[model samples]
Target chain A: MDMTFEIIGWLAGICTAVSFVPQSLKTFRTKNVAGLSALTYTVYNLGVLGWVVYGAYLKSYQMVVFNAVCFAFSFSVLAMILRYRRRSRL
Target chain B: MDMTFEIIGWLAGICTAVSFVPQSLKTFRTKNVAGLSALTYTVYNLGVLGWVVYGAYLKSYQMVVFNAVCFAFSFSVLAMILRYRRRSRL
Candidate 1:
């Protein structure tokens, strides 16, 4: 049971971590900001950052690592939105 | 110290939970998924579902609840993507 839960947790962490990959790629490739929400990514990145801090406090290495990974993906997405949105304006 | 961490956790949870709202709303209102990635939302939903299950095992109310909220938002976004993409094709 312990091992089972461990697998489940890791799977959950991996899923959460990798979930941003497709969006990041699509957004970067297409450079479309039409449907993406800047507010969502901004707040999401902040939350992910907070999770990294909280995880460190709790010493939950998985959370720290995965959320950090997630943060990178999301932060890049946010940056893309800002960049693309700016370019679109100009 | 404990209270501080607790507050941090809840704030993190709130951020994660509400982060999806803007995207969902924007997607629904604009009906523009061009910038969105179906694979990302699909995998993200699955990951969040996993979190709900893992949280249940740990009896973490916040995890279960926040993740459930996140799931709903992401799921709707996924559904909207399918719906709109189909409509777009037709």
Candidate 2:
């Protein structure tokens, strides 16, 4: 049971770590922030950065690695949103 | 220093918990999934659920609380994506 829970945690970590891929890929290709929220990604990236730092403080490699990957993907998406944001629709 | 990291982790958790709100609200209002990724939210929801269960096993209320809030917001977004996704845009 303990091992099962551990596996669940590990899998959960991986799921979140990689989940940003799809959004980043689609945004990268489409360059669309029409439906994306700048505030969401902005806060999310800062959270991930905090997590990375917290993980480092905790000496937890799993936390650091997972959040680092999320940061990379989410930050990329956020940057794209800024780059391609619709300034004015006429 | 330790307390600072703890505070960081707490803040990080709160940021993640609330970060989904803007996206969900925007998607709810605009009914746009053009910039949203179904797979990302789908996986993220699953991951958050897993974290809730993992927290239960670990007897960690913080994990459960934060992730449960995230699940609520993110699931709403995912539902919006499925509901509002355009089909056969011609």
lDDT of 2 by residue, B1-90 (tens): 899999999999999989999999998898878878999999989988999999999999999999999999999999888876755253
lDDT tens per residue, model 1, A1-90 = 978887888998999898999899988899998788999998889888889989999999989999999999989899999999999999
Candidate whose DockQ is highest: 2
Model 2 residue runs over 4 Å out of place are: A86-90, B86-90
Candidate 2 residue lDDT tens string, A1-90: 899999999999999999999999999887778999999999999998999999999899999999999899999999888888754353
Q: What's each prediction's TM-score? A: 0.97, 0.95
Q: Which stretches of candidate 1 lie over 4 Å from their true place?
A: none
Interface RMSD, per-candidate values to 1 decimal:
0.8, 0.7
lDDT of each: 0.91, 0.91
**B8: Cα error in model 2, Å:** 0.3
